[model samples]
Target: MSKSQQHDHSPLHIFLIFLRMGLTSFGGPIAHLAYFRAEFVDGRKWLSERSYADLMALCQFLPGPASSQVGIALGLSRGGYAGALAAWAGFTLPSALVLILFARGLSSLGESVSAGALQGLKVVAVAVVAQAVWSMARTLCPDAPRITLMLLTTAGALLLPGMWTQIGLIAIAGVIGARLLTPVQAINHAPLNVPITRRTGVLWLMLFFTLLVGLPILTHLLPWTTLALVDAFYRAGSLVFGGGHVVLPLLQAEVVPTGWVDNQVFVAGYGAAQAMPGPLFTFAAFLGASLQGHPSGFIGGLICLLAIFAPAFLLVFGALPFWSAVQGNRRMQAALSGINACVAGLLLAALYQPVWTSAIFGLKDVALALLAFTALMYWKLSPWLVVVASAFIGWLVL
Candidate 1:
């Protein structure tokens, strides 16, 4: 049966399905991807495995929340624009609301919350990123040349820390990949038959680029506080590659040095974010709510949330019309090969700097991280359970 013939085409059905996933989905992006594959592909048969994998690859190459973009793409194929909105709202709102409320309550707590627990959460992040790096490296850079590219990318990222450096490396890797990486034999996939048209795709891509260029200038000229906030968050979202975890470094560069939110609060929110179900981009909500500027409340949270996600939506819509055609192209395959390898390397760099450096201080920290990693890798425990356990252990020992 075609996607059009599937039952439960209502936007509400889409919303409810995603909402359940949002509430229960744990681990990080990788885990979320697993849950999504099981639910949509294996259980519901909403998409064939080949089509799902193709969509996943497309979203992976785009600069935004990868899993979230996949979810949006799935919704669009299922129920069109309204379905996409419903899917996003359901998957995102749970975590966003929690973080917003947490920020509000955190302000009242002052210094009373357990620092050890927070540190534990950061340690959990270390384990989580480590797991992601291992998983992605195995899948994305299995070949010797790809492995070499991954190492080079990691070294360059560590040596030169900036958004431009990240972008430059990805671009260079793509060029090299086009020259070097062998293309995979393309597998034919069932067409999703989404409603996006070439014209709409062009418009979405144009708007994406326009906002990328125009938002900064508008903020600079107008100097409106809200505009600036949107600009900052939007840029953070626009430039993020790999996955949501990478947004950490980009966002830190944007907000932390500027003192928009204190380092302690930022770390706390990030640690808490690991425990949340949906996209790690929802961390923007916490930052907005915790901000000391004009948009520092519910409205601020909403604005920042919307701004950060807008780029992903635009890019997905823009690319959807052409994705199937490009998926089978050798040139596009080579580019993806390079880009995916670099993404693994980028995740490695991220794992070391902010995640490992900040979280691991002593033997105790190492032990806790190892324990969490074991739970995730060996025991095959739920990430949420590992997170809660790690926090408890941290509070007790750290």
Candidate 2:
């Protein structure tokens, strides 16, 4: 098929396609990738398997939600920058809306969802995160050295337990990896036909860093709550590596300690997010709507939803033009390797503190969590089904 005929190349069409998936794609990031490949590669023939794999690899290397970045990249390839936005909107909005409503219900009705059901959600979060840790550890920390790095990262994160500490550990891990580790040689893939020029790509990169560095300073000096909100969520989005699950730790660090969101609520919302279909980053919408003070509704949800995702948009667009050159850099790959290990470590730490300590209060809670984990890990049941069943169990027993 001709290039024009192979892809619709219409922003609206792209939005509608992703919107459908946003509603129906129940599995997490890994599953989202499979869905994307089936639709865009096998069904639509928008790109060849090699090109799609290349895109996925590039997104995996960059820091942010991988599946969302892939969607944005695909949109950019087919529909330009506008298409990227449409793709993100289509894929992101459904879950964001659901989470926002969930948050609103919690805020307005306080006990609309029973404490047991909410606790069940929190218990399920433990299983979800444990699965993430297990899966990522196998992939990112295979060798002894990388495993040591992950263990040390977990130790440092637990001892220090803050956003800055997590950042410091990631940086330190990268340095260690760059100095000590040797990455496998990179493979070459067919060039992606993205519309962005390298010069424009450079400009986007500059803007990404500018906002990354400048936003904190701006928020510090100005004391505008909204800007602070932006700074927090943007930083969370900017630094999240590994996968959507990693965002759990980064976000809990950003929102929970600051009194912006309650810890219990945060964990509950995370559980709810797992049940939702789309990017788990839409958990930002829940945190936003659950904010303690001003801007704690749809408006807050919009602001935070945009802020957290903005980095992904900028990074994916900016990096696409330069991916070919950077993808093969040995040191860069090594650094990403270290960062991924540290990310798994961070999640490990989080699974202990907020997710485990809060939810697994009694032996019954422990039993429910184990059951949920078994259902997720072995039975291969749908996550939403597990979530609903866990909620019912929590209501019935815990």
The candidate scoring highest on TM-score is 1
TM-score for each prediction?
A: 0.69, 0.64
lDDT of each: 0.80, 0.79
- Predicted candidate 2 versus true structure: per-residue lDDT over 57-127, tens digit per residue: 56766788888999999888888888999899999999899899989885443446677776786777677
- The candidate that wins on lDDT is 1
Worst 10-residue lDDT window for candidate 1 reads 183-192
lDDT of 2 at 255: 84
Candidate 2 lDDT trough over 10 residues, lowest sum: 183-192
Model 2's TM-score against the true structure:
0.64
Model 2 Cα RMSD, 1 decimal? 7.4
List where candidate 2 sits over 4 angstroms from the true fold.
1-7, 106-190, 324-398
